[model samples]
Target: MSDPSLVLHRIPETLVEALMMSLRKSKVEELQLRTSVLKPKSKVVVPSMRKLLTTEQSNKASKSVGRKLPVPSNQIRDIVQHHCSNKLTKGAVEAIEVSFEKFFKYLCRDVMAICLHAGKKIVTQADIELVMKRQRFIKDNKSLQILIEQNFPLEYRQLFIPVASSVTLKQRKKN
Candidate 1:
C-alpha cells in the first residue's frame, strides 16, 4: 500500500500481450507495462474518432441536396492517395466524401438563409460571400473573394467571381 507495488500481482502473459497490441494498434506514444498503466500526454485520435463516420450525406431541413456531387469520387480518391503515398483506404475515401458533402450542405444552407432573408428565392455567390463575412470573427469579405479567385478552376472563375475593386481617392486644393 505504501509503495504502490503491484509486481507481486502479476498479469497473464496473454493479457499483457493483448494490451501492448492494442496500444501499438492505436499508434500513441510508446508505453510499457513497467510499473503502472501510462497515459499519453496528448490524446491519440484513432481512439476518439467516431466509428460512425458518415459514408453518405444528408440535406438541410428546408431543402433537398443533390445526390451527385460536383467533385468526382475519382478526384477525391486521387487527392487522398496523393497525400497518403498512393494509398487510399475505402473507409477513408468515403469518409472524405461524406465530410465534403456535409460541409457543402452547411455552406449552402447558410447561403440559402441569406437569400431568404433578402426576400429573394435565388441563392447566389454574393449571398454565399455575405454569409461568410457575417460568420467570420473579423470582417474580411475581400479575403474570401480573393481565395475563390485564386483557388477556383480557371474555367469557372470568370462566371461567378465578385471582382474586388480598388477605391480611388482625389485631393482637393483649398484656399
Candidate 2:
C-alpha cells in the first residue's frame, strides 16, 4: 500500500504540464487545488499547478497519485453556473424559459419526422442536417401552391396549411 503522504518521485514534466493545464482550465474549475514543492534552483516553495486531474488525466495520474480517477461530466454537472455577478442575466434566462416549450415541441416534431421518414428512432448528429433542410424547404416554398399534398401529410402541414389556405380560399365568405 502506498503512503498518502509519499507522492511518487521523478514525475514526467509533460504529464505535470498537462496535469497543471487541465486542472487549472475553466472546464475543471471545482476540482482546483494548490500544492507546493521546492524547485532545485530557487530553493523556495513554489505553488504547483499540477494539483488536480481530469478524468483522462486522473486515470493516467492514478498510477502515480495512487487513487481512483475522478468522475466525468454528465447532464447534472454540465448545467452552466448561475452566478449572479457573471455577465448572464435574469432577462436572458427568462427569454430562454419563454421559448423553452416551443423549442422542445419543435425539436420533438423534427426528431419524430426524421424517424418516421428514415425508420430510425434513435436521433444522432447526422439527423440535424435533415431537420434543418426540412425546415428551410418549408420556409422557402411558402408561396408555391401545394402541388402534391400527398407526399407531405396533413398532420405535419397543419401549421403551414392555414397560412397557405388563407391566401387563396376558393369560397370568399366574409371581410
**TM-scores, one per candidate:** 0.40, 0.26
Query: How does model 2 score by TM-score?
Result: 0.26
Cα shift from native, residue 15, model 1 (Å): 33
| lDDT of predicted model 2 | 0.49
Model 2 residue 35 lDDT score: 20
Stretches of model 2 off by over 4 angstroms after superposition: 1-88, 137-175
lDDT of prediction 1:
0.58
lDDT of 1 by residue, 9-110 (tens): 454555766776776665543322321255535344333432222334322321344346667888657545544665677767767888888878887888
Name every residue pair that clashes in candidate 1.
none
Q: How far is candidate 2 from the true structure (C-alpha RMSD, Å)?
A: 18.6
Give the range where candidate 1 is weakest over 10 consecutive residues by summed lDDT: 164-173
